[model samples]
Target: MVAIDANEVSKRYGTLQAVDRVDLTVEEGETFGFLGPNGAGKSTFINMLLDFVKPSHGSVSLFGNDCQGEGVAARSRIGVLPEGYSTFDRLTGRQHVEYAIRSKAADDDPIDVLDRVGIREAADRKASGYSKGMAQRLVLGMALVGEPDLLLLDEPTTGLDPNGAAEIREILREENERGATVFFSSHILEQVEAVCDRVAILQDGELVALDTIEGLRETMGGGTKLVITLDRLEDGTLETIWAVEGVDTAVATEESTVEITCTNDAKMDVIVALHEAGLDVLNFRTEEASLEDMFVEYTGAGR
Candidate 1:
């Protein structure tokens, strides 16, 4: 089931086309990552989903209801942690959280929410005195006020330290385990890889790839970095590697090591081909391709 569906959404600013005709669907109870470079229209797409920016052309639905229909009843069912969010500096952390709970008509206690986000000890402190990471945590805690069914986070961990980031990730996991659908947008590919079940990558306001990590790798001409310890470099080795199907590039040095880049399901073939090339393979390690590599390959190559 799709928790959020965007059909052929397009947004334009003057002569600049921010979001092209893009289609996206986020499954219920899934942690979906929205990834893109700057100016790739991620923010525009998110704003449209929240009804903050009306799409130039297209439709948005949340839990099978039109996003723009009625008085944002659909929005009340979801939590949002926007990028560069700021709160009233004079309000104490506890007051901010209490206000958010009351505004959302939530039944949960604000103390529990503060503790869950690890900000309880400092709840009575003024927001003006909180550090960047602490302020971000308060914002996230505000979003958790009602335990909404869906969470829309934009760069949720932007100003956090490693420990804080880990804490936030753990909280997200716990929420997902409790059956909440999480739509998290971020440029940090490593964080996305760690937390998201599926990812959609956008480039220059265009959707380039959408799939599981493994699936994306397969579609981008799968790359494998081979660290081989050879007894000695042998002749015909380079020629033999190029002969392997899907082996797009190979560099072998006189130092008895070869690094290879290839496509889908080509590692085993590469190993066999290398052995066939008559080099005594002492140890071989293949580095799996990451989302960054796929991004570079597709966007950099102008695909």
Candidate 2:
């Protein structure tokens, strides 16, 4: 079964098209990433999926049930850590997880959920006294109740420290391994890159790019990094490499290595060119473009 299906989905407010005709499908058990800048309609799209915001046009279905028409049926086994989630001022961490357990009719231990999100020690503290990061963890713990079949997280790492973020990523990995379909939405490229099987990029409320990270890199001019280790280097060696047909940029990084950004087809040609120039090639490798590179090229965010 398709985990999520959004067909020509659109949401408009006044003169603004918050989401414009986005067509997307996420297969069951797939870890999918949804990325966009702030106000790129990511949250709006998510709201539509959860039936919290009605789509102005089109339809969305979850597990073969129309999200808006059959809200409870569509979302029964789904868990969500929504954007702008807040903790109740009086509820302790344990109480929040317990509430989710009760809501889901699950038998999960509250302390176990708190421990998984790395806040077991603070489980007894009132959420009002928790820091921003702690509150984020509390919500995530709530989302993990019932061993949900689908996890829809919006900016899951918001307000987390580096260690806390790492913990969340690890938890996501565990969730996916246990057969849950993870629909992760965040602007933190690295987090998405770490766990997502495929990613879709939205820009200005339109779907601009959708593919695996490597696939997106290929679309964006083969942003591959080629590093060549030579027996020695000379002043004109880099200039010679830059003159190659597919080499984009070449720089001497060390006494014996030249790192080049070039097309995928140029990697071997670069080594051949160096050998022809009386240089002994010792080692060479190519690294695919970073997710950040793809994000910048496609969305022009953080440019």
Off by over 4 Å in 2: 225-287, 301-303
Model 2 quality (TM-score): 0.81
For all candidates, the clash counts are 0, 0
lDDT of 1 by residue, 1-303 (tens): 788998998999999999988998999999999988888999988888888888888888888777877427668789899876898899998999999988898887878888998889988999999988889899999988888899999999988988889899999999999899999998778888888899998888888888988888767576665566777777777677778887656666447887666764777787787777776788888788766666555565311
lDDT of each: 0.83, 0.88
Clashing pairs in 2: none
TM-score of every prediction relative to native: 0.82, 0.81
lDDT of model 1, residue 238: 67
Residue-by-residue lDDT tens digits, candidate 2, 1-303: 899999999999999999999999999999999998888999999999999999999999999899999999999989999988889989899999999999999999999899988899998899999999999889988999999889999999999988889989999999999999999898888989999999999888899988988788777568887878899998679877877787766767788987776788888888888889899999988887787666765675321
Q: How displaced is residue 106 in candidate 2, in Å?
A: 0.5
Candidate 1: which pairs clash?
none
Where is model 1 more than 4 Å wrong at Cα? 226-261, 264-284, 301-303
**True-structure Cα RMSD, model 1:** 4.7
Sliding window of 10 residues with minimal summed lDDT for model 1:
294-303
Best by lDDT: 2
